[model samples]
Target: MIKLPTISTYYGGKGSSGTYQKIINHVRPHDTLIIPFLGNCALTRRIQWPAQVIANDLDPYIIDQWRNAELGPRLDLYNLPALDFLATVLKRPNLGRVVIYCDPPYPLGSRKSQQLRYHFEMTDRDHEELLTAIRFLRVDCLVSTYPNERYAQQLSHWNRTEFQSQTRHGAATEWLFYNYPIPEVLHDTRFAGNNYREREYIKRKAARWVAKWALLPPHEQQHIMEQLIIVTPNVIVNQINN
Candidate 1:
């Protein structure tokens, strides 16, 4: 497994926990992940490495912290308002296979009826605007938020799945709204399987295959790999066409 640098602690930061893997399962290694409302960038750090990650936040302090963290070349940090940053990204040419993951602050209504303050809070209108902005984008998008009638109405056409997330206060239900159909095969096989046990089983099976391959002579190994490279594309195309 690829090791990624850990993001520093920030107020209102979504730490490296909860249902982030569920969201990452939908991403491919080739996808350019855009985080418009980057807080701690919990999701960006945990996703498959060597993937392009563009993250922006309104707070310059957080952006500077990330700059000092040495997060490597794969991640580009931007200090701009979420929507403005997204607008800049949209103007760029040839941004291949983009996936925008929106984790804006929880709406006021969803904040357990208490006035919880953050450095930047997304008002009801701001949340609506964010959702509206991504609605027309050609790239795939996934939004993480609490369940509410406003989102239900706005994202009625979008696919949704819910999972329990631990909040500072208690457990809360978090929802993911996505625009694309779930691929039968995830781009990153590391995130496959329905549960941890199944995942471990697959991992062991993969290790066994690697062990077997290692025993092959160098020339035979090269031949097998070349054959796989030739056939893999056609198999992927057939899957897509089916």
Candidate 2:
């Protein structure tokens, strides 16, 4: 199979189906498919393999959207948490070679009150739980996550490989997780590269600073920085003294 690009035009992109189809071609005909987090079901709908798929998510609205869709795999969008979904998958007797594609929320420290955010941050403990869930499956599995040191360490236990691609906005690094061994030849396939110009633009935009006081020791730094924006004299002069 060919190497698929990782980047998407949007978070839930339309080209995901093509990527899913490539993945399906690698697996056997009667394997069971389990997708834990169904954002838009674009990928699930595109997979044409004749396998039993159990697509689910904790988001009720997303599940509702999947339920109302005219096409896609037969999904059971559960309202339960991720652990609950894993338990349900474990209890299934027809646990053949299972393929799981998960895109859990990348919870950095910046996301404070997002509705879809998870409580426990992405740490080694959470990574262990994720890996344990992946191991629980009786069949082959594939997982995806944003590139981070913690996630990289977690994925090291699996047949890990990296894919880089560019979206319209910028570049992205995606790691693919597989339980069983894959050949070396499949690993060398060339995928698309990220647009460096766009990436640089975003980097520059995100490089603004609050103040050195904000960067002081955590205990010494004031808590108001979260609610207030500290401006330099140049900024103040530009606005008032001009």
Candidate 3:
């Protein structure tokens, strides 16, 4: 897994994690990464060209957006059920070094709560089916999820990392499991969101945002920087200095 450049830039709707940048960075420009379940597609938009991304989801709305996006050769849009589409990609001849980076629907913890939360829903069986396929396929993959017993047992050999990212209530824990060993640069992410490292976090985050500003598309770049209490690079500097 080759590490691409790091950036503070992030996107996607609710429940989205910024750690995908680590997964995306590892994808080599020459290889193909299949996005089986493209949600709001923070990863799809962030990917710079020369590296090809096949972005697909069951949602027609998502497909339409992708089709209209003038991303040039960097992205290909499709609307297909994830499992069938994944099967199709794998069967293709001459497909070299393919990586599947996906975020699927979370398991139905509460039918009542989940029904209101997400349009699409998943079950334990669905999770099992996907895991079964992945286990036999012999491919490199990264999947994100909450901790589950089935996953721990099935993917025991795979590398795992615990991540902390912001969510509505406060902080949330998410797990990233990869089929191959991830390098330290990709795995050892320390986000100082606490009061203890407040000054240091801002300084580091400022630098990260700076690195990504030029590379990211203007709209995405804007969204990422907008919610920040500290806005521009110059302002970030001012806050640190003050």
Top candidate, metric TM-score:
1
Q: How far off is residue 113 in model 1, in Å? A: 6.0
117-190 per-residue lDDT for model 2 (tens digits): 43223545655687666654556667765566665665676776666434333555556566666632221112
Off by over 4 Å in 3: 1-18, 22-30, 110-113, 184-242
The candidate, 2 or 3, that scores higher on lDDT is 3
Candidate with maximal lDDT: 1
| Winner on TM-score (2 vs 3) | 3
Model 1 lDDT tens row, 1-242: 54544555454445535466677776543457788987776677666643567889897877876778776787888988899999998677766778888988888887775676667887889988987888767778888888888888888888888877766667778888888777555555675665567778989999999999999999999898678768796655644542
Q: What is the lDDT of residue 128 in candidate 3?
A: 88
TM-score of each: 0.81, 0.57, 0.64
TM-score of 3: 0.64
Task: Please identify model 2 stretches exceeding 4 Å from their true place.
Answer: 1-30, 70-73, 107-128, 135-137, 183-242
Query: Candidates' lDDT values, in order?
Result: 0.74, 0.52, 0.61
| lDDT, candidate 2, at 177 | 68
